[model samples]
Target: MNAPNGHSWHPETGRLFRLVIDQLQCTMCTLTIHDTHHAEYDIVDMFNMPDYLANRLAIDIDKSIQIDAWIPEKSNQAVSFDYEGDDGQDRFCGLTYYCRADPTVLLALSVCWQDGSAPDEWRDRREAIDAWVDAHLRLLWRSHRDRGRVGSLEHTLNLFDFTVIVLAADGNILFANEQAHALLDVGDGLRRAGHSITATDFDDAVRLQTAIQHLSHSDEQTKSTDAGVATVLLLRRANARPLVASLARMPPTARGSAATVLHVIDPDGETRPLVGELCRAFGLTPTEATLAHHLVEGLTIDGAAQAMRIQRQTARAYLKQVFVKTDTHRQADLVRVILNGIVPIKASLSLPANGGNGSARSGAK
Candidate 1:
């Protein structure tokens, strides 16, 4: 295909530099390439998926040639290839350096030409391009070289504080991570059993179950632009703020069993009510509210006092009043009480009362 620019090929200063090749698809994942003078070009496109590309990149990398990954046998060194861009495109070229930090690379830098083949004058400008390539590659390598690697599943999951649980179509608990187990033991909010799971409200219980049932019967195995039917519900408590809970269908595995994934977020635990709201809810003075805010940020009593710019004696008095108002005895327990229970800034939530005995209903999609 002719260059989309509709001009004579000028490799030194042309559209080639815009063709950045960031993704290299393997047998594991999908990848789409941007080609031509525009990201929208689809006429000269090519597609391939198999093990041959992996094996080729492995051996050619040791040869110190332009053929890093998926380079054809006829290709020698690098820069631009005028004759072989999908048999219709004029040409393409760019650097394909490997990462020094590891045997595999998740990213790379490739600047290509879209309109025409590289000019014969590329020999004089090759050094400039080399400098550009070296600068970016070295920066990437140095940034990741010294930080040791630990990519275990547990390490990754422990980094998040959300409670996640996966269940089979029949409501059988399939997988529950460490945070999920702890949340289940917290009591009264969400309960898990060998057979099924339930929420505090009967209506919520039915809604969640029905959502999981839909996931169990899921047939779609690939992601699409169209949104699927998922359910988001708030796990409310009369005495404390609610948790945002979501249920979505996990695509079926190779063995053909689909499961439902449950996600719960406790954003309330990280929020502090406004000073007026805190004073009204827990009957604390302005100074006491300020102290409570500092404590909620995980500061010690002494630290909170210092943060609020108050004397030790005055801070102690404020803390005493805070404990009394919030109904907690110790600083640690007081922290939990304030953060998880007292002075919660809740949004007004109203669920329609359908013609049923229960006061709640599921807001499933």
Candidate 2:
């Protein structure tokens, strides 16, 4: 592998340094050597290197010899180096070990002293330090990789219009998407209490808790029979439509401790079916598609006509065309077809500004 740039330090490096410091009382630096003519490299120092010694080392070292000598043909070899300052008052000692997992990477353990005297015990403890590095190197790399994957997944989930929350087996909140956070912030039907999510209503809370637990802790035989199925619960709201929440178990092969995912859909939330999608799928004109969009958003025919500023008769004419093109004769079936189809899964142009009740002008083309 090529060398990481100066700014590219893995977060797990700090934890590894903490462990190393406790054992050796030395500064730990992980260097990635570039396969270049100048032997360019990057180093992660845990802020343990003193400013004076760091400046002197940068100004007074031969780049090739200082960096390239660390690369070993065998994994177990340890290379040592010592430098004396101009007055012979400052001394520096470092041991570089080859990384078994990545050939281009090197681990340098060093210490500096103001007086000529420095600890020689590092030489005796060389074997112990090398063994510790070999044992923890792979684990730290895995942790860094997993953290990156989780960050990417969180960003992807934030793009959706509905709420998504991931929970552990004990119903603790492991992750919550942007929409879920907003939903909990409002404290209407559902809210986050302490570390877990709960419904405001007594009965709804019981059902929600039970569903999460069952899906999270189901036995192997039960999981096989309902592997892909999601358990649905309706959470009631005093002022508006009830929220629909679907709970499902994360697959056994998933990496993290997240055992259940709750997907909550608010009925009054912004409807995001694209006008182009409706037109292409149902072969309706833009005007007809607009009317269909309003219906799917839970508007009655009169309400849709009023919202569109069209005459009642004109709206009825558009609805008739939409029904014939979509092969659905009733309003309920039209909504069912659109919701159950692939249109709702398409990315929305924008999120609602008012959290749940905001309206966006449909982009009809």
lDDT of 2 by residue, 1-365 (tens): 23323443566566666766555556534433233235444443434555455544432332534554534556556665676756666666665554545444343333343343435675666677777775666555566558889999888888777899988878889889888999999988999889999999999999998888788777777766655578988899989999999888886545433378888998876554444464455566667778888887779999999999999999999898777777779999988877776333325543232222211213222
Candidate 2 residue spans exceeding 4 A from truth: 1-45, 51-71, 82-91, 100-118, 251-258, 272-289, 298-365
lDDT (0-100) at residue 144 of candidate 1? 37
| Residue 99 lDDT in candidate 1 | 26
lDDT of 2: 0.66
Q: What is the TM-score of each candidate against the true structure?
A: 0.34, 0.67
- Residue range 281-348, candidate 1, lDDT tens digits: 56566677788888777788899888888898899988887777766788888767655554332222
Which residue segments of model 1 deviate by more than 4 Å? 1-151, 219-229, 271-365
Best TM-score goes to which candidate? 2
